[model samples]
Target: MLNHYSLWKYLIVILVFTTGVIYTLPSLYGDNPTIYITQYITEENHQTLDNILLSQIKKILENETITHKSISLQTNKILIQFFCEKDQLKAYQKLLTIFINKYQIFLCTTPAAPYWLSVIKAKPIKLGLDLCGGIYFVIHVNTEVILNKLQEQYIDTVKATLFEKKIPYIKIYKIKNHGIEINFKNSNYRNKSIIPLSKINHGLVIHRIEDNKLHIIFSEIKKHEICERAVQQNSTILYHRIHQLGITEPLVQRHGIDRIIIELPGIQDIKKVKKILSTTASLEFRLVNSAISDFDINNNLIPEDSEIKLTNNGYLVPLYKQIILSGNYIVNSNTSLDEYNRPQVNITLDKIGSTIISNFTKNNIGKTIATLFVEYKDSGKKDSKGHPLLIKHEKIINIATIQSQLGNSFRIVGISNLNEARHLSLLLRMGTLITPVHIEEERIIGPMLGKKNITQGFTACTLGILTSICFMVLWYRYFGLIASIALIANLILMISTMSIIPGMVLTMPSIAGIILTLSVAIDANVLINERIKEELKQGKPVQYAIYTGYRKAFTSIVDANITTIITSIILYLIGTGPIKGFAITTIIGVGTSMFTSIIGTRAVVNLVYGKKNVNKLSI
Candidate 1:
């Protein structure tokens, strides 16, 4: 009983906490300090629009004493950069639209860089793919790769089993058509291998041929494990990559065995995301043996193309191929400017990579490297003279004095702009952007779509409850009215639970979960009402029947609901995304339903039973 009360108290606490949560999220997320808003006006007469927006913003910034700059007009756009607060976001939107009725102005917010900045008039409440658009890539994990891995695992298991019994096998590999290729001299061991392995749930479809090769077809279950492993590996890789990208709450989930879904809300530059995802980030450092001309680098004397492209700076690079030294090798990287005010990136290498780099540099200390090839490309066409030509340019420079205490750490000099330096650092960290992936499926909901979805979802929920309430009153009379009241309280508890729970995500699927809960709440009431009718028909007194009906229903309701809750728990443990959402709501709803139906409805029923006489009861 104490545990039950504590649960109810928890529900109440959640309710109170949720009201505060709803009010606080907008402030925390909306008033982010790093947002910049810029407005583009293609035509005239938008000066008044700009002034009005400035005034509204100025009024809001008064508390912070943040002096509002009058909007600055550039070539095609008027830029406004300020920290936005929650209470002011709605008003800011209204101010921007004040001249929408008159002027032909184009307004848009750039996707914030590195997932922190926003270029909106306000921090957008509903994140859209356009405003926060990034890349969406789905790689079809090859089934053949999974099968091969499984085959290797099976082969290892078999080898261990055979070696224990003093049997020897030449080699093992999975045959393309279907089965295992095992070349063992002993036929007795091969026959024995099949019987024990078959019983081990390996799910191999067995086919024995007269030849040495044993044909095996993997069952759906066995094949599925391969795909599952691939998916898990991909998810892990993506999780690490997203962390490297420094994105908060990025959606990295497996859609199926072979497909993954990634959502970087408020990310701009889909191209950048694609580049980041496709890079393996494999870093290596090789000695620049001798300065080579661009012509030699491009002419296939070098292996594959390198990833690096030399700017004005002289250094050896990967030329868009795999990096010799990746960000992983660098224990740390920082940004600085050179003496000429040009941007430069400093990187500190890890112990191993540093050792390799140090040794390589030490070995080539006195080499006067005149040319360091940064980029090599197949020109593919002849010059104006029409002769077959491959253009190669030498961008590598002579080696400067190498610093000894610096270990493997080095600096890239001569970046033209701060943005360029930043880009270079990112590319270096990402380990060269070669063959970057592109967005396969991009779903962007604009502000208008968000509003529509919100309106529709709310309307659907309201109508569902209203309809349920009407049915309950019409059918069960006074007791039904009591159940209806309980249902409303149940809903409040659901909202409160969702709002206050730390890991809960109130997604579209969660709304359906709530509605499903409402249905279950109604079902419990129906069960109680029917049980009451049964008691009254057996000649029990009105009050006695009412009390007995609830008492009898309580055990059955608890038993049934407990089973449902357990199932939902199992689902939650095994599922992901929307499935988990459904499971979560089901669990919360079932627990809450037991309270409102068993306690809340009973409380109201006791009040009604007290008001009525001894012998008459309305169902």
Candidate 2:
């Protein structure tokens, strides 16, 4: 008589499949419509919005009779989650118009996992951007501009040190060799000033040259530091800016020394993206003077300390070099319609800027103040000599006369449209970029295409599994039917195992991995069956062949799966995005297949064939 599995072995199998069933519960519940209300919520708004939004949502739900699974008021966000897509869409369409400048509403999809399951930290596999709709951008920052700006800032420091130390110099200017050249009255003045310059930090090197000139240069180490810092700070700015645009979990990564890679999942609006990402905004408030003598428009400018700026209205205004206030002092910005029904930007300054602006306007009541707009873009124009330049082009976006003394709050009138007003407001809130950037690569993935891909991938997986099941049953007969049952068990265990793993993404390539796993699952079954046939042909008893077959096949199965597992580990470590997805699923599926193909199929064999004393074998 054949031996049945021991109680402990039966208990182990039961425990594993039970755990698999529990984990599989999450995948059974499909995705639901999700609404996210993300905004830069201040403490005052946080307390006020709780009750206001709750009441508003109540009224909206009462009118529409739409019920939501949960309404979570998180920090900096409000999430209205529902199991039904129609209800989610209806609430989104109704509530989005109300937030306005207060918040941004985005429609998304999330699994309708139960509260208890979520409490246990269980979640279904996340879909990748390649499988979900999204946009990709490769942005290249102009490190030259960053370096040039840093040099100019340091030049001011150098000038200050000379004045503070009372070192006499004739003239100082930036040189083409990434250094500043300072000319003294004589070599004695330059040599005497060298001691003071030696006290300077900020990675500046001062060297004396011929003709009473001293050169201040940045070392190679400092240049490398500048490049690294430029990328890091810009990445932080882009992350903040994207979140402000209502995107969750966006990937803003550093590619090279001056390049950045950005991925926004579930975003399809290219225009909105351009407005948020492409605009390089900087604000400057300067006094426009009546010093026409200061400007020789034919010669490009008039004074060293002042420059002639052309306004949008075709008027040339000479602005002082000193900026009274910049975007750094801004506290908030909002878009609204003016008394003339034209789009306008209402800006609020910080406490310091408020005091400064109030005093400046009071002293220059009849004077004209200009708001200089600095933008970074490739204007698609060549230089006079046919060379191209991507630079920060500064012009006067708005120029208004000071009728009376104004305070921290002011309006920017004459915006072309409401869209312009909104875009400007967003830029001001996000702050200005340290340097200009260009979008070197752009791609858009529509939601429709994403859905099509999902359908095709899922259909292909289903067809593949069915074909394998049919072939297994036809060739192996009773044993094949048993193998097919284990195949089903293998799939359930694979999905459940994958779902439990943290941060696993189910992508298109991952489907291929799944199908490949199923094929590999049959290989194990084939090994066990062929070994059993060989033992039976050698005149061994059915019971001995059954036991011996498994003993011999186990080694081969271990060796084959071990190699595959190692390859998958390598792939996961080195791959990106979809490739990582494939590797993760493959690794998990291989482990699950090993168990189901050996232990699971053998348990069935023991329960059916092991309990009898028949000499005939099914295979």
lDDT of 1: 0.56
Clash pairs of candidate 2? none
Best by TM-score: 2
Error of 1 at 553 (Å): 2.1
Error of 1 at 448 (Å): 3.4
TM-score of 1: 0.52
User: Which sections of candidate 1 miss by over 4 Å?
Assistant: 1-249, 256-259, 264-284, 290-324, 329-332, 338-342, 348-402, 405-411, 414-419, 426-435, 474-482, 499-509, 529-551, 562-584, 599-619
lDDT, each prediction: 0.56, 0.78
Task: Tell me the tens digit of each residue's lDDT in model 2 across 541-575.
Answer: 88889889888999999999999999999998888
Summed over model 1, clashes come to 20
- Candidate 2 accuracy as TM-score: 0.65
